[model samples]
Target: MTERQLPGYRRIANEVRAAIAAGEFAEGDRLPSVSALAERFAVTTGVVVRALEVLKAEGLVIARHGSGVFVRRFAAIRRSSPARLSRARWGTGQMIQDADTEVRPRVVDVVVAESPAPAWVAEPLGLTSGSDVLSRSRRFLVEDRPVQLAVSYYPADLVRGTRIALTDTGPGGAYARLAEQGHAPAHFTEYVRGRFPSPVEAGGLELQAGTFVLEITRHAFTAAGLCVEVNRMILDATAYILDYTFDA
Candidate 1:
């Protein structure tokens, strides 16, 4: 059916969705009350409620128990992969993440452990399937809302006596420490995909029911063709904008 021929609720939802996309409504802006929307659309209050439900499921708006509906306020993050991984960013004691966003993400709940490599991790690192690897896991937040989770893996023997094994990798982070040990990352490759988050990921990210997640797996290689680090990241799709720029 055409737009005008669609059901009442669907039509209302389309109008509201378009308005939001056109910036008539902004983040955290309260939507009109149900009665007001119903009056404006010449429909019943039930139709307006259904329309709001559609927006809520699609993550465009949120309803507070007694405070009415408002545009979801989670600030979107722009991630620039090449710049974030550039040597110039980390070589001068700057954080790689600092390159991705103007507002820095707070890293929290960091955990460090040594474990047997999973098959996926081993192939990228060129290690035996069960070789030990040092893993560092952490969560990134913006405005107290969890937005990303990451785990970086390195061969146990390669970082055994280094700061990379610690929760705090000091000034420049992991890539810097790798440089000090003569295994600096000379180049990088990233693979990206999207899917619904798992239960654990959904909880960690505090995602809306229908939101999706973006997975980015990055392999860091040294000049000698050795894969020194494999970093896997999970991002709340609704909260990210992936920007990749390259010269043609």
Candidate 2:
């Protein structure tokens, strides 16, 4: 459908968003109060609230508790699958995520634990149901803003005593470290999809309403055709622009 045929709330959001782009409301600037906006738009406060909600979801503005809604200071990172996944990126001890942002990305809230693999995790790691695996979870942040959440699984037997089982994979990250252990993956495959975030994911990314989440799963396989690692990722859609390039 055309934008002009959009709902009232969305239409208002587009106007406010355009104003933001036009510099009428610069980043980090406070927006007119809901009541004031309602008076100007000749609509009720509820209408203005809904319109602002739309903007919030689009990552155009954010509502601060005890303060007010203000334009967001956001920088969109480019996630170019080809370059980020090339051996040049991670093989050199850097990660695909690090290349996506200008500033170095930091891993936070890391948790490493051994647990029975869930159905989804099991199949990816080629593990039997109820088989144990090492699970590593971390939040990747750029410039102090959390942009992605990642969880990876490896068969307990494969990473038994490797750094992959630890919080710090130490130099070269997991994939490179795996190579050292003689299980280097020569091929990688991943699937990507986009959807709205659940409450939990939204909270983790500090996303406002109307935002969508990009879900990605990567399967790493050794030259021997053994699936060694399965990584699941969730990204803040509004914070990224996915880029892909290849030869025909």
Distance from true location, Cα of 11 in model 1, Å? 5.8
The best candidate by lDDT is: 1
- Predicted structure with the largest TM-score when compared to the true one: 1
TM-score of each: 0.87, 0.81
Model 2, stretches more than 4 Å misplaced? Answer: 1-10, 18-40, 62-74
Tens digit per residue, CA lDDT, model 2, 1-248: 89879877777787788899999999999999998888877877887899998887777899999799999987678787777777787778886667774755678999999999989889877778889998899998887888899989898998889898887888778888888888887778888999998898888888776678999998888888989988999998877887877679
Q: Indicate the residue-level lDDT of 54 in model 2.
A: 84
The CA root-mean-square deviation of candidate 1, after full C-alpha superposition on the true structure, stands at 2.8
Residue 171's lDDT within candidate 1 is 86
Worst 10 residues of 1 by lDDT: 96-105
Candidate 2 colliding pairs: 57-209, 57-210
**Candidate 1 global CA lDDT score:** 0.90
Give per-residue lDDT, candidate 2, residue 81.
76
Candidate 1 lDDT over residue span 53-131, tens digit each: 8898777899999999999986578889888888888898898778767667889999999999999999999999999
